[model samples]
Every structure is written in C-alpha cells, then in structure tokens.
Target: MSTFSRLGGLLLAAALPLGAQAELPAERIEPSIHAELAAHTRHFAQQIYRVAGNVHSAVGWQLGNVVMIEAPEGLIIVDTGESVSESRKIMAEFRKLSDKPVKAVVYTHFHPDHINGVQAFVSREQVERGEVHIYAHETLLQNVVAQGALVGPILGVRSAYSFGSFLPASDQEGMNAGIGPLAKAEPSSFIAPTVTFGERLDTRIAGLDVQFLHVPSEAPDEIILYLPDNRVLISAEVDQGPTLPNIHTLRGTRFRDPVQWVESLDKLRAYRAEHMVPLHGRPVSGQDKVEEVLRMTRDGIAYIHDQTVRWMNKGLTPDELVEKVKLPPHLAGYTPYLREYYGTVKHSVRQIYNGYLGWFQGDPVALDPTPPRQQAERLIALAGGREKLLLEAGNAYLKGDYQWAAELAGYAIRVDHDDKLAREIKARSFRKLGYASMNINWRNWYLMSAMELEGKLDGDAIRQRSVEMREVFLSPDMVRSFTPQSFLQNWVTRIDPQKAGDLELTLGFSFPDVDEQWALEVRRGVAQLHKGIPEGTELRLSMDKRFMETLLTGEGGLVKGALLGDVKVEGNLLEIRRFLACFDFADEAFGLTLR
Candidate 1:
C-alpha cells in the first residue's frame, strides 16, 4: 500500500469509536480527531479544482493554496504555496491544464507561505528582465524584512511546534497541520516584489483585467484579488476554508486588530463574488453562500472582540473572560467554516483582553510574581514535599485527570531537576494530553513535548532546522533594502560581547558589483557600519555583491571565500579571524514548552 493509503487505514481504525462530531474539545483528543486529521490530509488533492471558467485551485500538500487564472496572454498565479518543493508540484499541476508561461504573480500577503515560493512561478532572471511582473502591497517588502530581522529565530521555533514541523509525518504521530499537510523546507525560495501598490491597484495582466485590494487582515501586507470578468475573489487568509480564522496565532505575532479584520471582511463581502477562493483552503461557490460565510466570519470575530472588552469593563480577569465569552447559538451553530479548527474563542478572548488592556489584571500579586521555578519549590514543600506531590500526581493520572497530573509533576520536577520519576509521569501525562487535544497545534506541541522529555528530540537539531528555515526565507537584498539604521540595529545586537571582550577592529568592505563601500567597526562587542571607510582600518575585504551575500548568510567561511579569491582580504589575517569570532551563532535549540 502507498504511504497515504496506509495512513488512511490507520486513521479509519483509530477513529472507529468517534461519532459524527468532527472535533473534540481542546482538553482531550478522542478517536474523531484522527478522522478529522485524515480528512485534512486529503483536503486538497494534487489535481486542480476548478471554481469557474478559466479559474482553478491547486491545493498543495503544504499549508498555502494557490489560485490560477488562465488569461488570453498566458497564466496569472495568485499566492504560491509554502515551500519551493510544494510550489514545483503546484506549478507542474498547473502545466497539466495549460502550457502557457506565468504572466504575473500576485502576493496575497508577506507571510512566508504566501510569498516564499515565487521562484517556482517564474525565475528571478525573468522578473529582472521584465518578462514576469510580481505585485504586492507596498508595505510587504518592508514588513517581511522587518519581521525576519526582529523575531525570525524565535518565531521559527514556535512554528515548528505549531505546525508539527519537527515531528515525523504519520497517522500515529504528527499527522498534519490544522490547515494542510506539512511541506518540505529546503526547496523554499524568495524573490523581492517587482511592483508594489497601496490600498488599490487596477491593472491588466495577461490580457485580463485584475483588481488588487490591500485587505490587511492576517498580515498588514495582505491583499484580496478580484478577477471581475470571472467574478471570482481570491480572499487570501481572510476566510481560510472550513476553519475559524487565526485572529491570534499561538505561534507569536503582533496582535491582529479585530476591528480592522472586520472592516477587511466588510470590504471583501462587497465584491458579491460568484466564487470566493481563500489562500489556505477550499473555495466557496455561489454569490449568496460566499456572502453568508463572510458575514458569519465577520460577526464571529466581532462577537469575541466586543464581548471580551465588555467583560473587561466589568473587572473580569482574563481567565474569567475566557469562560464567560461564547458565540451565540445562531453563530456558534455555523459549523466547519466558523468552528475552532485552527483558532478558538477562548484564546481569542485572552488575546483581546491583553491586546486592549495590557498584561496587568490590576492584581498586585500578578504585577510582581515569583519566578515559576522558585514558586514551584515552595509549592512542592507546601504540598508536603516531593514524595507527597508525586503520590498525588500518580493518583490524578490514575483518575485520568491528565491536566492536574501534569501540573503536579511539573511542580515536582521544577523543584528537583533530577526527579526522573516526576519527569516520566509528566511525559506520560503530556502524551495523553496530546492525544486528547482538538487543536492541531496544541496536539503537535504536546506530542513533541512528550518526545522532548523522553530525550527523543535534540535541541541542536531543532536549532539547525530553524536556522535553515530562516535562511530559506531571508535574502541579502531584503536586508540591504532596510534603512541603514534598522540594519545596523539588527547587526550590532548579533555580536557576542563576551566573545569580543577588549578587541577592537575596523573592517572595510568594497562591493565592486554594487559599487557600495562601507566600513564596519567592532569594538567592545559593538559593531556599526558607516558609508565610507573609517580613518583607522585594520583589514579590508573586496568582493562582488554575491560574495558579500554569501558571507552574511554564513553560506561560506571567510577563510574559504578568501582562499578561493571570492573575497579579497587585505591587512592582518589575525584581525579578520578575531572579528569573525565576535558574532555568536544563534542557539537554535532554544526551549519552547520544555524549559
């Protein structure tokens, strides 16, 4: 049997006890979770699903989905899938229907899944040569780079947990991300936007009239594409299939304003689209159905946001707010599209409370609390010592109270790091919790955490994987485009002060290909770049722009590049080596839930 077939059979067996309900509550995963997961695995087949004449959806195994429009001149591609590997398959599928070249590529947003697969649609050379035009929101170029430079490493690790990026793909294990199956990371590529516009851009591409509206929902750089003649709306992440929109992703990001999101939905609802195709999931057909879904989605978000604020005015704490907020029977009855497959109402309430009211709950105890570990130590003693806590935890586990058991075990282990018995109990509790989780991200994180506790996953491996993922999305041009002040801030913070110590050196860089010359000074672990050469320089490296990019990305060693004449180094070799040693390589295996 094929892998997918074998997995499907396993899912069938696992979900035998599950009833008609598609998902269980977040506290526990039951048999039905497997059925739902299996459904997600087969959600979008490798073939095209035509929504209208000349408009088709190609669903990739990866999270992102692409829409293709067959115009008279050629083809127009909207929102490429997650990775280069997935994009290649998506492109091949498009070719099966039409052999025309991609005339234009439109970005739905600056999210990695939406825009990372650009090279698959058209080569970078084609973009530079004016053969293919890439369009995106004007803020896309800036936001993409800024997000990467600021929180790239931290977010990458969280994403691994949220998307099951590090877990093995199998029915018994990671299964799939909530939206779609996981895609390979290595085959990812990024190309800068060729053309950018603000709120609206109406133009003709491939002999087809197109309208792009910057929606600013999931990402500030988001846009919704409308093909008027076809009456199809590519609604980006605004309406992601049969799942509730992730207004606040557990994988950290800036708060998505609920008010703005509702407004974006309002604008999209005005289109009266005959078919509404979202970037992440299956498309909606019929004008009335599209409007209905958009309305429910809008109202659902507003309900969560407005109610959370209402209760906040009543002096309710975040935890109390979570329990208090719930969709009305009418809206809650709307299944599939408005259900909590990806985002839940409880989390949304917490996000709303924090986003609007800040972290303080007006509780002085929470304002300045003891560190968890220190508190755990006291808690363990108050519970009659580690042995007493373990006894209680064991009883809780026996009673199937996995959440409480895990909490007790956590306290015991934190109080004594060498508590192997406590760790084992906690790991088992995590496994049970993972199995019971309805949220796919929660499931993945719980399962991964269990494995991590058992020493099955290495932090170093996670670190390496995250670094590679970051490298795939970031490019030298993206870095260069940042204002010098922004660029310097990112660069200087990367230096390891302990490594540099008292060493002070100036390095001059001459990029002959770009005709840009700059001087970099590293003193007391502080690094800064200036436009012209500094008065006192210890060493100089002259290289083509390409070589500089490679150096910054850590693709090639400085000594190797210098030896190969890729970088021409002058002055003291010792100073160059010392300068290179000052910057610390990122710690990829940084803890998530484990530590």
Candidate 2:
C-alpha cells in the first residue's frame, strides 16, 4: 500500500492512509501524483468568483488574486495582483461592476503577489495628493527592502527554481504554479503605503467599517481585514488557497512559526463572519462552510506542529523525523484543503525539527560534517571509484530505484562535476522523482534542477528575468524609508579588498533634499563609512535623495540628473572614476543551479 492511492479516474490520491499511499504497484499503470497534479490545473483557470453581493475575487489573474469590494463612497481594493498588465485587465473587469473610482487600497502583506500591482488601481500622483490612500502593516516596507537590497539576487535564483519560472509554459514542461496558473516576470510598479499600523487598526474606508489585525504568519506583516457591516472577512495568506499551506516554502523563507500561524488561524476563526474571501482561493459564503474550512486549515497546521514536537521530544533527528511524521488518515485522506499540493508533511517535519533545535542535533560528528564534497569523494572511492558509481546509478535507474540512482548520480557529479553521462543519469532520475511528487514546490524544484542539469535552461534567458525581479522587488517605493545610513552601510560590504588593497581614497556623498552628509573612506584593504563627510575627503558628490536612491538600485537616471545639474560632482574626475570601479558588482550571470 502507498501513502495514498489514486486509481484511474480519481482526481486526488489522498483517499488512502499514509502507510497505504507510500507504495505503488511494482509496475505502475499510470503515475498517481502526476495525474493528480495535472487535474489540479482545473482550479487555476482564469475566473471571477463573486464571494458576496459587493465583494468579488479575481483568481488566476496572477500568482495571487485581486479582490474588489464595493463600498458606499467608492471601490476599496484588497490585494492588487502581481503584475501591472494582469491587474489592468482585472481592474477593467472590476469596473464593469461599478464605475466608482478606487478610493482605498489595502495591502494584506508585502509579498510581490500582493503589493506589486498597486499602479493599476491608483496612480502615484493620486496617492501623493491624498486622493487615494494605500494601507499596509508598518513592517511591510522594511521586509520589502530587505528582499531587494540584502538578498534579492540569491532569492531570484531560488524563486526561479521553486516557481518553475524558467520552464516552458506547456502541460509537459510546466503546468500550474500550485497556487496559480503561472509564474511570470511582468512590468510591476509600487506605491509607498500611506497608512501603516501595528497590532491592529480599526478604521472606516469608503464608508465601510473595517479592522486590520497585524498577525505574523506567512509574512511578518500579514494582516487580516474584517468588515463589520457586511459580515465579511478578507484573509490575506492565512487561508493560503486550497492546499496544505506552505508553512515554509522550498524557495527559502524566514522561520514561519507554526505556532504563530496556528494562532493567526485562530484569530481569523474568532470573527464569526458569514463570508470569507482569500487572496489565493475562491471566496466562500455561509458560516458553516467558512468555519469548516477554517477548522480544517487550523487543524492541519496544528497536527504537523504537534506531531513533530511529539516525536521531536523522543530525541529523533531531522533525518528520522522526515520519515516518521505523516498526516493521520483523517487529515491526509479525506479533506481537500489539507491535501499535499503545495506543502507536505515531509518538508514541514524537517522545518519543525530545525525550528526547535536548529542546525545541530547534539552530535559533534554531525555538527561538523563540513567539506561535503570531500566527503562525497571519499564515499565514491570506497564504493569502487567513479566508474563503479556511474554503473550502480545506471543500474538503479533501470531497476526503478530512482532515489538510489539520484543519490549515486549526486556523488558522481560531486566527484566529477563536468561528467556529461553522470549529469544525464541524475537529470533522468530527477524527472522521474518529479513525476512522483504531489507538492508543486517539490515537483518544480525537481523539474527545474533537472532542466539545469540537462543544459536546457539558458543563462542569458535567466539574466533579464532576474534583473527585472530585482528592479521591482527593491523599487523606490520600497526604499523610501531607507536613510543615508542604510545606503552607506551597504558600501562597507561592497568594497573590494583585492582592488583597493594599495589604493586609498575618501568619497563624500551629500543628499541635499534630506540634508544629510556621509563619507566612505577606503584605507588600504578596508572601507569605513561615517556621518557628516570625513574631514580628509577628496571627492564629494551631491544629489537629491530620490536620485541617489534610484542610482543605488541601478535603475539608471544618473546621466540625466548629472547633466541637468540636479546631481553635482566635485573633486578629481579621473580619481573618482577609478575609485568607484573598485566596488563589487552583482548580476544574474552567476550559475543557475551549479555551485
């Protein structure tokens, strides 16, 4: 018996117990998880769902839905999709319901899918003039900035794999984005939030009574919106679509406290509301349906957390826990919401183990398993050299032992990274594993990694897409809160030790609009940033903070600003240019999957 069984014709395979769902027939007539994943595409067709008389949700428009709520004074938009182009189409459809101008935009959180498409609903000029107000949790700006400034490049690669962003847009290569139709890199814009709050904010928008609760869940700034007058509850990521909520995404995320997420679910349940609209899934009406979904979603998370802790107390390692923890038949076999579409018991158990105990498992040998490549080299030598290893991997693949084949191929690659045959064996093994995977994140990661291994994914194609992501992810609206201090601090890390080893110089920066002065002094091999331009500075550049911010993200308006005298340059031009060239730079040309 397998963990779950999907005979021919059934859509979901979670009808069986974990023990039963683990094994398929020795000869698989049809792959179960693959069929189920293909069937899951039905939920992602572009459609508009009317949750209530006044509230409608546009799912499949982008990674997340754009929900529109009609109010007495005007239309209040909640969650404005991911791309400007798609949101424009959604906004056009929303206009058919009512021609009311968008008065207020509520950002449930700072995910690109939630906040990136703000320009389609309201113009930056309108927001500046106070005609349209955007609302969000106060921490939204900081999180957004960190994603762009601190970790955007690495995240871009990881997200590309997890979202299958580079895969061909077809049923064979790419099907659905688990939660949505596809992952696209489109022109996106941002607007700074005008209204920010902590804990909770109770206010009236467009003549409708609304309350925003700041609960940390998927994102630290996640907030749920409640409409008292209409008895409607807008769940941001709390009710994360119709799948097992990704307590932790494979693309990498901060620790999503399962306890906090469960508590957030409880907070949503407290609102005994009649209607519910999720930013990811279809809206629900009737108190009973809402409660049922809420209860099941809550219990699914609680089950993973509690069960993992139960075994974790017995001194089990993460390796052991991934195999040990499984959803009880009730949660895994029956309900649609708890099915392993995006999140899985295997991944969540490891996260729980790490969350509670961190990287170490109280074993010194495990603590310093450093030099993993050397370790693989030694293991391969012990297994009779690279030739024998390749032979075993090929045999394993032929015998339908894909896991063993994949592991053996991994060792072969580590020993000889450029081995074409070794890479081919591993790529084939990964494709088979991907077909057997039910969680879309795991499936996509497998498929994309296989693509990278097979030389199918082009680096040139990836560079432009990653650059676009970096641009919007760290746009000016996100960096509005950054001060001269933040930008100066970044310069410390950007300094190049090899290039500036014997070169010494001082550069001063003045943001006239902000009335701030800063200086970076490079001494031999190190750089130091100070406030109020250091006395020995040889070069000083003055510009408005806005132009400076734009330059920081590489958006390119510096030439125009300099020619117009908006940016003033002082000191030796030749020396300044040489010194500036010493700093490190980043681009998407880095390896897509290989180290």
Q: What lDDT is reached at residue 85 by model 1?
A: 70
TM-score to true structure, per model:
0.85, 0.88
Candidate 2 on 455-511: residue-level lDDT in tens? 777678678657766755766666666777777777687788888999889889899
Query: Candidate 1, 205: how far from true, in Å?
Result: 0.4
Regions of model 2 farther than 4 Å from truth:
1-33, 171-174, 366-370, 475-483, 499-506, 521-539, 553-582
Model 2 residue 458 lDDT score: 68
Top candidate (TM-score): 2
Q: What local distance difference test score does each model get?
A: 0.75, 0.79
lDDT for each residue of candidate 1 in 1-595, tens digit (9 for 90 to 100): 5544533442342234322222211222232254555565566455577988898887655678888899999999998776777788888888989999888898888877787777778887898899998889998877887677767788777776676666654424445556655655653466778889998999999999999998888788889889899799999888767677788998788889999999999999999999998877778899999999999999999999999889999999998999899998888768677766678888888888888888999989988799989999899789877666766776676677888988887886676654556666677778887766666767777877766665666767877767766754565545545443344346667888998889878878777776777877887878887887776775888877666556556677668988898989889888788887888755646656554
The weakest ten consecutive residues by lDDT in model 2 span 6-15
